[model samples]
Target: MSDSIVSLHEPGRAVLPAYVRALEAGWSPNTMRDVAPEQLAAIAADPDAFLFGLNGRGGKIRLHDGSEVDRLPGIIRWIIAARGPESQFVGSINLRWQEDASGKPITELPPHVLGHVGYTILPDHAGRGYASAALAAVLGEARTIGLPFVRITCDADNAASRRIIEKNGGRFVESFVAPFYGPGERLMYRIDLQS
Candidate 1:
């Protein structure tokens, strides 16, 4: 969202105010353990978490998801982030990825890919261009962590998410279905940070 801001949590420490508020609002924390081994290690070392709208006891609860829980089917664990006006932490996004749809395994980190970009913003944060902002934040994190590329997977039906990925300079890589998940076609996009 324009005029809104997001902030990165301090290394290995939770922003108590935002975190407690999110929990009081019925939010849970996600762990990278939900994704892959490498992802888990990364999250563990960095402790990436997000919080949003915890600005007060109740200024009108905006929205909170993905930050506490892995909205993505393949996500094992994740952290929370926050965003606000005059602040700089408004949305939640993750650096995680799963196997390629081609049945090829990604047991090890790829030199060109940091992981997948999974971003989510609260309802109130939507429509004001917050999604792309969160995505940009994640990209910065990727660069800081020395990642070269990232993947983004979206449900074929979610045009909104697809648009967000496109706005982040994602290129159409393929459209396929994930195993044991469902018959729904998924759009996989790739963005290279090395450029």
Candidate 2:
């Protein structure tokens, strides 16, 4: 069995070599864009900054399409599935605590984006159930925050992601064209937190 555990990114922590491995192996974040070597070096030197940037605490977010969005006032937690407390990083999950302007938990997500939770496992760590484990752990956090349900979206052709969502009790909602990302129709799945 894998010894992976999912936890929020911590500051001042040692940079896991697995991140370098992923980069060296050409695994970028879900954004699917290449990161500069200097930036990678900076991340390894201070992973806390990378986590902060991910959580929106550092300011804007640069998307894969080269668009930038101002960080909204919501809990953007970055969860990492690692082999152990001090092991390589296997995968990452982004758990966004959905809330409205009044800070109340929002059940429905904005129509533009894909989902409340997004995850990706390294190529070397594929087929190890890391995605499902990380998704389950983040769903627990969603329940803790009083979210009724969380929406997840994936490309219609991603059989692996479809299986992962299905294994975690995701129910099929509908298939819609994701105009924001591209022209392809994406599958939407919802997991009721209260269940």
Candidate 3:
């Protein structure tokens, strides 16, 4: 089945069950940390609120260190779902950016965040071109949202992820360790949406 990016909060999209299963099986939407257990518990407590909160519309974000901070402006999330009679959650993708005094989006991300876009696909659904397709779609969204470009990062050792970024027109920028994402040799890439 083909995959497409869908709204995380779509009323007709019943994504929680598949999402929960992925978390239970040790898959995390965020690659920076292992917070799936906490997230799963939160989802179990209130499914609707949990789904609605994925886009950071709640205005606050809890960090892996258990600290809460105001959500960054222009943060949005979408589910990567397999399309068919029964669409299933294969993964999630998100975009975040800082805002100016007038609330316009900026390319600068928060100090702790390593990239403008981040995504993770379930282990079972890997190697199917889903991440590539999703990144391409989100780059279009980025352009529509007035971003001239987007920066994305993946672990340097993660060849598959690196390939996905390059396939989406990502140009390698640098290699460094992102302390916020823990210890790892991370490679940064930029996709110029204006092109």
Q: Give the TM-score of candidate 2.
A: 0.79
Report the C-alpha lDDT of model 2 over 1-195, residue by residue, as the tens digit. Answer: 222455555322454455566667777655445664644787777777765665554266566677887644344333455654455566566666446778787876655457888777777778877788777877877888788988998989999999999999999999988766878978999999896
The TM-score between candidate 1 and the true structure equals 0.55
- Report how far off residue 52 is in candidate 3 (Å): 2.2
Residue pairs in candidate 2 whose N, alpha carbon or C atoms collide under 3 angstroms: none
Best by TM-score: 3
- Decide which is better by lDDT, 2 or 3: 3
lDDT string for model 1 (84-128, tens) is 324433345556433457633243343322236655554445666
134 in model 3: Cα distance from truth in Å?
0.5
Report lDDT per candidate. Answer: 0.50, 0.69, 0.76
Which lDDT value does model 2 have at 101? 75
Is 1 or 3 the stronger prediction by TM-score?
3
Ranking by TM-score: 3, 2, 1
* Candidate 2: count of backbone clashes, pairs at least 3 residues apart or interchain: 0
